[model samples]
Target: MASRGVGAALAIAAAGLLAASALGKGWISAGSASVGLMGGEVCRGGKCKTLELPEKDGWRTTGTVAFAAALGAAGLGLVAGIMGLARKRSKVPAVLTLVAALAALGGGIAFILVAPGKGVMEHLAWGAYCGVGGGVFAVVGAILLMRAAGAGPSYAVGMPGTANPAARTLMLAETAKVSGPEAKTMAPGMAMAPQVQAPRPSKGAPAMVPPCPKCHGPLQFAGQFNAWYCPRCQSYLQV
Candidate 1:
């Protein structure tokens, strides 16, 4: 239930992590030689040489992207956290933070997972962990904030998305229906007719009898001729 507090706390933590990751150095380190977002040094026999890469886009470029993305995520997460702590329902902050986090995650993957380096510390780098971790934290925090921002109520009866039983049962008392000549009262949210209907026959009902057209008298059944006989009318009657 304490969604606001929880969401705010998570966002703050994510912001802190991302901020540090974006600014910190030592993305990769082996002994005294260490690498960062821009460049690092290579040492041999107590001597060190500056690493030089192609002028075009390279791993450093990806690292730079990652650094920028991390910073963006941090800023967004901090804002989202502040909004959540204020007990305000705002989806913009959460959504933007999630987007920035995803970008940061993509950058981390590009440099930490895809790009290759000469040394053994290429994949096992502290800066890489920080970037990835911050992204993950931001993503989770954004999700919590989104949840904290309440959505509207679900539908009532006959709705697939309806989740509240109470809503489904609302207005269930008064309903009216009419089928054929008979009027049938029904409860709201209930079917007018049952799944199956039982057959009924009238009791003591005389069939195959008709009144004479002219005399208006009941015609007698004629079993032998398969018709009716009107004694008063004295004519063959069809029943």
Candidate 2:
């Protein structure tokens, strides 16, 4: 993704430079005539006779400014790409690359607007190229940002079904719930019969007890503990 962004920035910058060059050529053709007060040539007789150029709206100024802006954006993208390569954990570089690409696109648009009428098609073509390049940078930068923020791809480590530290803790808790002693206590009645029984008959008394120590419910002691046990409270007491 970072590579894509860098590529886009470079493309946009190149297109802007190309458009600016064409505009500069037109400006040069228009300004090659008579010397003005500033010692620069002025447009005369449909041509500029003197080599000196006007300060503003001159072919040289237009081309130089446009190319400079494009190159600056390209430089920024290059720097961002280098930083991204160096700093694996940082998203700053990726963001800078996207910004650079956008700048290049903007410069291209400006060049298209300032270029001569006959060169409109060429300017539009350059603008489109820059737009596409900037779009690529933006997308790549976004992906990089997502990845840096831990929102892309899973690198979880821990239990087979879990992710990070918290997930591991929860997994262990759930496993304990399923396989611990509480699970055994809730098993089928067949496994609990011997453990839960009625008491033996007291001398000259009823064989079954009616009062439980824990809850005053009927008591039983089938045989395991040899003591009175409550079926309701599951408590046991020595006979």
Candidate 3:
């Protein structure tokens, strides 16, 4: 539960940061000109060129691509966060969150690597930092969400799908020991006594043992009480 809460919070934060990065200015060019996922301006002294979505400039094109990708990441991250907050174990949320991080990081880096040429002075700004931070948060949140999900049942070798090797044992190990009489004076060449097999746990015991309902720990069958026992909880379970 705690993991889910923290993960959801991080994912939501990532969504906000990533959205801001996409919409707000993140790069500076030509001294006074700035651009972001949306667009930028190219300025020379007192004159400034406003770049927008339909512009054919190389840098603006890159920003357009990044803008779309960043926006998608933000949307996906928001959905994933909401799903996690609701405590839903759906795998799609984690998967989508990870994909969001990848898309955001890729778009941001692409903008930086292929931003400008022809003597254009361009440097990263707060928007770029926000994208990076959001990507990191998305990754961490996805990991936490995956960790919080429950694991599927396991099967043992040569056993049915419902049968788990750990549950097959009915009771604790209770092998008989040979020590009552002449063990202290036994000859060195004597054969060892045969070990005694422990008794069956229950007459109609099921082959499968389930995970504990409380802690999800492995359970053992106790024949004397005809019930499943959780060693971790140190108590008998009704199932």
Candidate 4:
């Protein structure tokens, strides 16, 4: 639960950062021509021109890709957060959250690499800082969520549709072992031990005890006591 809460916060933060990065100016250009994320404007002899990102400029492609990636990360983070809330023990959501974080991180790196460095100088904007911060937060949240997934109860505990009948049978077999030991007797100064075969469910017969309705833990049938027992809840179940 705690991990889920943290994950939610981080995901929200990531979304905020990604939004800012997408809307704000992530790069700036100077010299004969000035180009920034918002737009590009022409300049001459250090005179400033209108701000716009022109389609003809090749560098704009890199910025566009990075922005797209950031947007994708933000969207994925929201999805992961929702999954984390609904399925705390599920690892799939955590993996997705990690992927989202990596996307933002990768995008930021790409933007840095492709940023203008020649006649058109580039400056890191607020969007870059926010994006980096958001990516870090996302990574931390994903790690926490993954750790929680491992510590939670089995996912199949309450979902009987996915439960394995063979596993339940094995569990019952192990439980039967603790009922009582084999009977032994000594006769004429000699000790004799009789072999006993564990009882098995008759072919096509229904199970002795079904899974607990609440916890889904294996149930034990106590023939001698004439009652079905749930080891998980330590309560006798109605026949």
The global C-alpha lDDT for each of the candidates, from Candidate 1 onward, is: 0.65, 0.45, 0.65, 0.60
Candidate number with the higher TM-score (3 or 4)? 3
Question: What TM-score, over all chains together, does every model reach?
Answer: 0.57, 0.36, 0.57, 0.52
lDDT of 4 by residue, 24-114 (tens): 6544434354333445566677675576554453556766666776777777777666676776567776677678678768766666666
Instruction: Flag clash pairs in model 3.
Output: 201-223
Over the stretch 125-213, how does candidate 1's per-residue lDDT look in tens digits?
A: 67667777778988988988887775323223233333445543442211112222223333244333222221221232345455666
Q: At residue 113, give the lDDT of candidate 2.
A: 48
Candidate 3 wrong stretches, greater than 4 Å: 42-49, 52-58, 117-122, 150-239
Residues 2-61 of candidate 2: C-alpha lDDT, one tens digit per residue = 543443344344334434332333321222322211133445567654454334445335
Q: What is the Å distance of residue 143 in model 1 from its true position? A: 0.8
Candidate 3 versus truth, CA RMSD in Å, comes to 12.7
